[model samples]
Target: MTPPFHSRISGLAARTLQRLRSAVSGRLIDPRNYQPPLPLPGGLSRAQIHDALTAVSIDGSASGELFGYASSDLDRFLYTLAMVPEGAVGKALEIGANPYFNTLLLRQFRPELELTLVNYFGPGSAQGKQTVSFPGFKGVADAVTFQYDNVNIESAALPYPDDSFDYVVFCEVLEHMTHDPLRSMLELKRVLKQGGTMILTTPNAARLENISAFLEGRNMYDPFSAYGPYGRHNREYTRHELHMLMTHCGFEVEASFTGNVHPDIPLGQADASTLNRLIGQVRHREHDLGQYLFTRWANARVASEKLPNWLYRSYPAERMAEGQ
Candidate 1:
C-alpha cells in the first residue's frame, strides 16, 4: 500500500493536473480576458470594476466576510448600469439595497442624480431579521436616503409615492422573491414613472452549471442557508421566462444581455472580444451559462391584457374572469 504522505502528494498532483487540463479544455475561463462593457459614466470605471473582480485570493489567502464575492456583486452592478444612459437617470430608487453598493456607486458616478436606497432589513438587522443592521450606511449615510422597512416584494406596498422615480434598479433580488414575483413587478411599475426604465438582473436558472447540477442529482442551493424562502432563490428564470415576465408586467423589454460568467470558469484562452462574440451568438439567451440575466424594461401605460392571473389578482376579479 502507498504511504500516507505519498498518497497525499499523489492527490495534490492529480488536482493540479486536473486544473491544468480544465484550463486547456475551456472549462476554466481566464478572468483577465473578461472584457465587460464600457461604463456609462457615473458608474465604476471599467478598470476599477475589473480589477476588483479579478483580485482573487492566491491559494485562498484572502480574508473577509465577503472577500471573494464582493467583486462579483460589483460586476453585476456595473453590468446592470451599462444599459442605462449616462446622466439620464434623475430620481432613482433601488429595491433590495444591501448596504449602499448601488446607491454609493450611483452617487459617486452620477452626482446629479438623486437616489433613495431601501431594504427590508431594518437598521442593525441583517438580511432576514427584523431588528436593525446598517453595515454600509456609516460611510455614505449622509450621501443618500436610507430606509429600513420590511418591504415584502410579494405583498407589501412600496412606501413610495406614485411615479416617484425616473428609473429603478432591481439587481439580483428577483429570484429570492419566489412566492409572488408578479406582485413585486406591479409594485415596481407603480413607483416608476410612465416610460421610465427599469434595470433588472437575476440569475439564469438554465445556466450550464445548474444544468449539470440537475443532471447529477444534487441540490444546487444550500437548504440550511438563506432567510426563509425569500432569502434563497426559490425560482430562477431562463431568458425566455424573464422576457415573458417583463412583457407581461406592463413593461417593454428594450435590451437584454448576459454577464459575469462564474468567476472560476475559464472562458477559454480567447481574447475578450472573441469570447464576447461567442456570447453574442447565443443572443444573450445563454445568460444562464453566464449566470446573470441583465435586462432593461420600460414601464408602459397599457401592458398586454393577457397578463397572467398572478398579476391580475390585484386588479378586478372580473378582469381575471374576462381574461383581460
Candidate 2:
C-alpha cells in the first residue's frame, strides 16, 4: 500500500489529469448552447438556479450545455434580422420567459415594439399548490411588459387574445418541460399572426460529437448522483428533430444556425480578426481550463450575455478553431 502522503499526491495528480481530459473536450468539435432563465426580482434566484442546473446535470455536464452554445445561436439569429426586416414583426410573444433570453436585447434591436413573455411557475410563483412558484411581480417588472401572467399547467392555452401578436419566441425552453412539445409548437403557430416571425433556440440533438459519443457509449447524462439519469429533463433534441417539428407546426424556417455563442477564446494582444479566431479556438479548445471560459459559457448560456461576437461564417473551422 502507498503511504498516506503519497496516496494524497497520487489522488491529486489523477484529478488533475481527469480535468485536463475534460478541459480539452473542446477539441472534440470544431464548433458549438444557454437555458431559459426565470425573471427574479433580486434576479436569477437560487431556486431557479437549482432547477436549471439540475436539468443540465440530468445528463452530466456533456449531454446538455455545449461551449459557446446559446449566445452564439442567438447572435446568428440577430445577424439575420436585417434579412427578415424588423418591420415584419410588430407585437411579439415569448414563451418560457423565466429568466434568461435577451428581452432587453430585443428591446434594443427593435425599440419601437411591444413584447409579451410566458413560462411555468413553481409553488412560490404558481397558483396551484403543487406547481412551480410564480415569481413576484417586481421580479420581472423591469424586463417584461406590464402584462405578464402565470398560466401554470403544462398543456394549458396561453392568456392572450387570438392572433394578438406578430411574432412568437420559443427560445431555450422546449426540452425542459413539454412531453409532447410539438403541441406547444403548434400553439405558437396558432398565436403567431400572419407573416409573423417565430424565433426558436434549442440544442441540436444530433451533434457530431454527440452522435459519436452515443455510438461509443459515453453520454454525459450519466447521473451517478442521488437523482436518476438526466436530472430534471424530460428529453434532449437534435437540430433535425427541431426542424421537423417547426415545419410540421406550419412555420417556415426563414433562416437558422448556431446562435448566441462566441466561439473564440480570449487571448491577449491580438488583432480583431485574430482575436475573433482565437476566441473560437480558445472557447472550443481550452474553455474548461480558465475562469474566462466559464464567463464566456455563462454569457453563451444566458439570453442576454455580454460576450463579444464575431461573424462565424467568414472563418469556418477550416480557417481557425481547428479540431485536435
Which candidate has the top score in TM-score? Answer: 1
lDDT of each: 0.58, 0.41
What is the per-residue lDDT of model 1 for residues 1-324, given as tens digits with 9 covering 90 to 100? 111210122244544454455446645333212224434343335555444333323223442434445554666666555556666648887787654455555655566677766576533543331122122322322322355445766767777898999989888788877566776888888899999989898887765445445544654663644456656787788877888778777788776655554453332334434343444456522223556777788898655444466333576565452433
lDDT (10s digit) by residue, model 2, range 69-184: 33334443333222224444478776655433344445545556677766565435433211212222224323223335566334777666667877666655665653445546
TM-score of candidate 1 on Cα atoms, chains taken together: 0.66
- RMSD of candidate 1 to the truth, in angstroms, is 13.0
lDDT of predicted model 2? 0.41
Worst 10 residues of 2 by lDDT: 291-300
Residue-level lDDT for 26 in candidate 1: 47
